[model samples]
Every structure is written in C-alpha cells, then in structure tokens.
Target: MSIENVKNVAVIGAGSMGHQIAMLSALGGFETVLQDINEKALEKAIDMLEQRMNDWVNKGKLSEEQRRLAFQKLRTTTEIKEAAQDADLVIEAVVEKLDVKREVFKLLDQYAPSHTILASNSSSIVNSKIATVTNRPEKILNMHFFFPPLVMDCVEVVKSEETSDESVQIAMDFCKKIGRTGVLLEKEIYGFIANRLLFALSNEAVYLYENGYADFKDIDLIAKKALGHPMGPFELMDLSGIDVGYYANMELYKETQDPKDRPAKCVEEKVKAGELGRKTGKGWYDYRKEVISR
Candidate 1:
C-alpha cells in the first residue's frame, strides 16, 4: 500500500530515537505504536513524550489541542505482536547489532501484515544484512534518522538490492509527511551517508587527541571556528552518545575488516569506562556540572 493509505506505524524501541520517531509519526496524523519489551521503558517513553509535547505547547510550537491530538494518536506496548500486527509500517530502532536487528525483523515479518513496510533506523548496519532473515525483503529498507529525530530534518531512505521502488518511495513520502527532508540513497551501504562522513571525521578527531597532537577542546574549537560546524566532533559525540559511534565503527570494521574502521582507542576507553556522554553525565567532556565549562 502507498503511504497515503498507511494508517498505522509501529516503532519497535523506546530508547533515544524510537520514542521520538513514534511521536513524529503520531504528530503526522498516523496511529503510532511505540513498543518495547521493557514495561518500565514504555512507561518512561509515554512520560517523556507528554513532557516534550507540553514543552512544545509552552514554547508555542504546538497548540494545546494539537498536543492532545498527538497524544491521542500514540499508544505504547510491551508486546511486539500487539504493536506490529496491524501496522502499515514498522520502524526498528533497537540495539545496534546485526544479529539483534535481524532477529527483530524476523519477528516483525511474522507479526506485521504482509503489506507492512519494515524500516531500520540504524546509523551503520545496512538493511540488506537484516533483510536476509525475513521473507519480505522487498518491504525492508533503511530509514536512518539522526540523533534527536524531532530536531534533525534529514532522514536517509536507503534501498537495498531487494527493496522495491514502491517501498522506497513510500518511505520517502512518509518522511516528508512527517516534516523531515528525505534523501533517498540509490544503494544501501553501512552508515548510509551521514554517519559515514561523521564517523570518519570523528575517528580522525580521536586519532589527533590520542596521539597528543591536540586536546579534544582544541579539536572541537577548530572544527567549530574553522570548519563552520554547529557542534564540534567531541560535542556531537557527547550529545549522540559515545557508545553509538563506538558501536558503529565496530560494525563497519566487521564488514570491511579494515583496521581503520575499528573504533578509536580513545572511544574504546570511554565506552569501557561507561562514560557515555550527556546521557551518563560524562564523556569526552563532563556534563555533570556544565557543558559550557568544556
């Protein structure tokens, strides 16, 4: 079915990106189900969405009635079958692991209607890797969203070799309907476009810092002042979570087997220490007190 006929969307995760994507789908007038196996996470996602929409109302970005309507469009569930059974589109934003994602798609194929389109919000893992586990590869594609889906306007719609033209078009149309600028990738590749470029830049930034050629603050400053970026590599990593980049790099490394694709030692150390950036209150720079102090 075309995006115009799609009435329900299922977002299969309640973590950082999934909940926001579900919110975006609901706000775009689709019945949205935000699903997770953890009951507490589903509860937290509902609470977070309420606070976020209320904040938007306070900021004049959304009317109180609009917020209420969006809330009405959303439902959270701990059951995967309940979320996917009737959904016209299912977006997986679970753990960034090939095996884990493949398993999710396998279940999605079992639960979702035959016409449902399955998309992944993976930053690195390509859709083809996960599609092989399912019978509906033509309906599987990557709809990669950047961190903080509400603020990021760009959405990468990646089509695998098995993905149908109609599925790609539907994914792009859905992105536009939800207020995001959709860029369709002609082919599927790890990291799509954004993460490939960002990860390469950040990998080098880590290299420079680890080698004592420059401090992270100096690197960030150079990237901001000289490169004309809104946020420097370190700051961006902190916001996106250091573990994210670390895992993405590892995934790429596994596919390419290129030592260069491996996570930088500095990033490895931070993830090992559990200093997962703003989420954890510490990362390349500590966020416990003030981010400005960095």
Candidate 2:
C-alpha cells in the first residue's frame, strides 16, 4: 500500500484525544472526520472545538479565514463504516482495551481501502495485537500523539513485527506535516516511548508520598522551584488523574512483569476508593475552599 500523501484523515472515537487529533488534522489542511458511537459526545466535541477556534482567532494565532477554512475541511459522524471507507488515514483512538481496539480495527480492515494507512492513538495496548486482525498489517503502524495535538509538538511512530519500515516512514512524514517532531521506534514495546519514562517518574513520586514523606503540595513545589520543572509530580498526576496514572503504570508492569514498574499500593488504594484527582475534587489534595486565616 502506498501512503505517499494522506489527504483524508479519519479519527475513530470522539473522546479527548480523538477530537484533538481531528482538530490538528483539519488545521493541517487534511479532510478530517471525527467519529464516535455516541452522538452526544460528537456534538460536545464540535462545540468545544468551535470555542477553541474562536479563542485562537481572538488571540490572533489564527485568522477568521483560517478558522473558516478549517471548519470546512472537518467533519463529524457516528457511522464508523462510512467514515472509514474514504479515509486515506484512519486513526483509532478509543479506550485502551485490546478486544475493543481489535474490534474497531477488524471493522475498518474489512471496509477501508487496502491502501489506507491504519494508525492508533493508543497509550497502553500493544500494537502487534491490533495489527494481527487486519490483512494488510504492513499498512498498520502506531502514531501516538500527545494530548492537545495541535499544541504539543512531540509524536511517536512505532512499527510492530508485521509493520513495514515504509509504513513507519510514512507516519513520520505525516506527523511532520501536522507540525510535530516525530520519533520512530524500531519495533513495538509497551507504552511506545514517552509513557514509559513519564510513568516511571510518577511511580517513584507515589512511593515517596506513601512513605513518611512531605505532603503532595510540598513535593510539587520542590520539583517546580528546585528542579525548575513546569509541574510537580502530584500536581501533574492530579491533572492527568490518579486513575490514568495508576492504570498506565499497571499496564507497564503487565508488559515488563517486573515488580519495580508496578504502581504504588497507595495509588491503587486511592484509585479504588474513587479519589481520582481533580475531576473527583479529591485525590492527592482536597479541593474544597478552605477558609485560611491569612
């Protein structure tokens, strides 16, 4: 399959990452489609995207003409089969479950053109499993983008056992076209690349907090001031969520089967208790307004 140019980009899943990828593709001049099973989710995504584009226009980052052009090239649909048929590049970005991903890929594999480049925005699941369901595995590659793809500049391209070098290079070229710095991996490993390093640092931070250590705020301040890090571990985890952090670390442990990579017990307990960070109003810190005597 030749992927010399990806003109039509389809993102399956109207969730956060999927919608963001659609936004970037549309902004990058591709005919973009964002699909989701839930019509309400797709509606919300479109509304949110309009607000963001308006903000960009207000800030002078994008002209009204550019925003109008972007909206023209973008589309949203709930019909998975229809979206896949004409897409030159289909990026599946649903929940990170092997069976779920395979089911979506299997459907796209049957319907999409054989030459269409099949990509995934998966953060945890292995690429090899998703590729095996499709006949043209060489056309399947992992093109993982960071959250807010329009803003973040980093991308990772992974080639699995069945994936071809040409596929990896094509993904690299596409990422550059979308205004990102692309890194290619030789083969599929767990977490691809960025998540592994990020979760490892988070695991240690959780361990520190669990022990007789400083409170979450203090630890965060230390990292921010002393290390000059943009965000502290706890603050970052809160933004990312304890549930997300713990789940990714657990997946890492599953991949390596090593005890060290495992998520901290305290994190497991917190996630189990539904203290899932900022969304829950409590995780590492209490969010209710405290009447402090200043």
Which parts of model 2 are misplaced by more than 4 Å?
A: 1-4, 255-261, 273-275, 278-294
Each candidate: RMSD: 1.9, 3.7
What C-alpha lDDT does candidate 2 achieve relative to the native structure? 0.82
lDDT score of residue 1 within candidate 2:
38
Candidate achieving the largest lDDT:
1
Cα deviation in Å at residue 260, candidate 2?
A: 4.0
TM-score of each: 0.97, 0.89
Task: Report the Cα lDDT for residue 126, model 1.
Answer: 84
Candidate 2 lDDT by residue in tens digits, 129-207: 7888999888888888886576779888888888877778778887877788989888677887788777776766767
lDDT of each: 0.91, 0.82
Error of 1 at 277 (Å): 0.8
lDDT of 1 by residue, 31-69 (tens): 999999999998988887888888889889999998999
